[model samples]
Target: MTMEQICIRLVKVDMLSPVRALNRFPSVIRCCASARTDLMRTNSSSSLKSRGSVTAAASSLCLRSRSGLNTCITAFRPPAERVPLIIQPTREFHTSGRLRALPAPLIWMVLKPLQKLIAIILGRSIRKWWLALPPNKKQLFREWTWRRRWHFVGAGAGLLFFVSLFLLTHLDESPVTGRTRLLVFSRENFMELAQVTAEAYMEEFKDSLIAPSDPRHQVVEQAVRILAERNQDIAEISSVPWTVHVVDGPTINAFVLPNGNVFIFTGMLEAVADIHQLVFILGHEMAHALIGHAAEQASLSHVVELLSLILLTAIWAICPRDSLAVLGQWIQGKLVQFLFDRPFSRKLEAEADQVGLQLAAKACADVRAGPVFWQQMEIYDQLRGEPTIPEWLSTHPSHQNRVRQLDRLVPEALELRASCDCPALPKADPRVIFHQAVKLLLDNAKKQENIAQEKKNEKERAGVILPFPQSPPVLTQGSQPQRGGVLATSALPQTLLSK
Candidate 1:
């Protein structure tokens, strides 16, 4: 047959096969065509030509069966043809080569215990070193006053310079909500950027944003409003138009913008067991906004960038070579991002936490929840098996240290809580709250089951074939199915999925 005829016959054979056809043939082809001719004699005279072509094509095709046997004309061909076919020995097919699998559990077993032991020893040594330090270190540092005058002068001068610069910048009212704000750019320009960023962030995480009417969204909004109203910093925030939004993510996080835009994740709602606990978290975020922490952080970051540029300029002036200047610039950039930017951010986080507690207590929320929340957070961090230093060195204070400080601040918090008469501050019993939560969970689960059953019924009523799962769904306590596999349920939210 001609090459085109052979190609057509091959296509027909492939279409008739009960398997997915290959997109393209491999570069090399090997098969036993001679055995196929001997098997075609049983075909009737009228069908001999077509049957012979099919048998020949099958014999020529380089297909392998699971049993290490080659595709025979009779076995591989359609059932209509009763022609017997013979198999021939051929070299094994190898695409790339077999890959060896690593024994992951074995490796983990050897490493995990060693890692824990080392961590324990190192932790003890560090504690000993810290305890051995002189108790008067803080006193000694506080007593040093040589640089106090210089610091005051430098701070005053820097503040005056920035104030003057800010005054020169354009001031305008926000578009979404008219509120006067200081900005280097015009309100229109700022909004354009804000809109672009908001749209991009929303699109990228659209699935994570809870519907406005979701119960969790309502909970977050209520907590935010309570915290905002009770805040001692309300006077500072009164001029700014504030809005709160709930992002529908399962990660425990919350952040506030300089412009009083607050975003809380559903994960945080699940983490916090009660309204008071939620208030503590929201109060902390609001503290960041009320104190102008975001602007302060931006200003510090800008200063760091400016310092890096100045350093690069100095290095270039000294070296006067293109290559040297480029190296200096690269090093300066990395130094700004790693050392100055990150360390400064961590300091701001600690400051916000310290101030946040004061605000929550002033709001008459349960002060005990602050430390308890941090303890729970520590448990999450431990389960994650994350590096301690990275978390400790983050923009926020170490969770353990924050918890310790919160414990120390309890008495002061209680005093503030006593002074407030907000009707929302009454403490609810944990057992009562937990029972209510369980009832809510059961009710939500039943609703979900009903919805699912209704959908199945609708498909059946339409006479449509519904595909049933081959295997039973695995249900584990505290476990949820991720995109790929099941994740341990402890990290899963205890609350039902918000409709």
Candidate 2:
């Protein structure tokens, strides 16, 4: 068959039954190609034009059989090379050579299974962990979750309350202290209370026995006096009326009452061996009063206590009473002691130490003695085998720590002591002073005992005696002479005059 006949037959086969074209075209094409075979095929003008330059392409085409020729013509035009069809959507292509426009639903379809798998894994892990936990632990976890929810709610309420308070109230600064302290109460009221309390204390304890004029007393007194004088030079101290009173006590303690009333126990005198050493101890106590530390501490504590009470009340209201009651009390106590009191005390102690050293220097006392005194205290504690007092308990720093701080202040103290022109007093004999003190104390005790006896006698007489007049009145209310009257009032007076 000729090329024209082959092309016509392939097209006719394709058009007639396209499904069987692949199977029958090879044999038909081979038969058409064979010189001996006489298979006739037909072609149209349109088919000849579409099969571009068939004469040139016919050289390349070899028909082994009529069927192969027909198959090649029908199924193998340009190999239909599967060249990744580029379909442009509405959006532009990305620089990454990927299409910018993705179908939203398709993306969701791809990610949905992955997301579900991740969720299933997390859920299973959590369930396993829950199952592995002890029963009590699981219960605790549940309780903790509930507690956290309540905590957040409480926090929100507290924040709202504070915000409202901030909006409504006025914040006033303290005038006397010059620090910007919160003045919730009027200064007048505070001053009035402090003044009344001070007066009552002084009046009640005016005769509270002081350490007699012993060597220790003189040392302590001199030290205190110098500190007071030095402190007076400070502008803050100038307005305060500083007074020192050395009380007789066995406990090694010292305190500065709010109104600059300093009371140093005799026990502290025994602890301090010399005037220079005594000054450091006294100076520190004085600083507490000078700086109004007590007032500051009281104010801070009051605020903390108030807040704790509010929280405790709220806890009681919301939770099971028995369950949370112990916890609430524990939290409240810890808040009061550690959060409020301990921190305030520690800070004040440190501030007092700093200020006291300055005061001691100004007072022209031996600043070096400060560290020596603390060292001595530490040594004494060790020698006695007594447990060192905690800083929190005594509102004072540890001896070792205080000594180290004092060491830093030595140069300043020495400079001040050198600059001063005042002559030092001669040291007294401790033995003689101790004896005198002992005698004085004994005498005072005896006096007290006598007074008590006199009072007891009077009470006994009152209890035994009848409430009756022993003698008649000489002057009647109506007939009594005026202020210038010379008339004798009683028989005994008239008899004595005649003699």
Best by lDDT: 1
Candidate 1 accuracy as lDDT: 0.55
Deviating ranges (above 4 Å) for candidate 1: 1-208, 317-327, 390-393, 422-499
lDDT of 1 by residue, 219-300 (tens): 6665556566655345655655567778867787888655566778767777775565777787777666655544544444
Q: What is the C-alpha RMSD of each candidate to the true structure, in Å?
A: 28.1, 32.6
| Each model's lDDT | 0.55, 0.54
- For each of the candidates, give the backbone clash count: 4, 19
All candidates: TM-score: 0.46, 0.47
What lDDT does candidate 2 reach at residue 196? 58
lDDT of 2 by residue, 139-190 (tens): 9999998879978899989988995585347344433234555434443344
Show the colliding residue pairs in model 1. 208-248, 209-248, 478-489, 479-489
| Residue 10 lDDT in candidate 1 | 47
Tell me, by TM-score, which candidate is best.
2
Q: In angstroms, how far off is 482's CA in candidate 1? A: 16
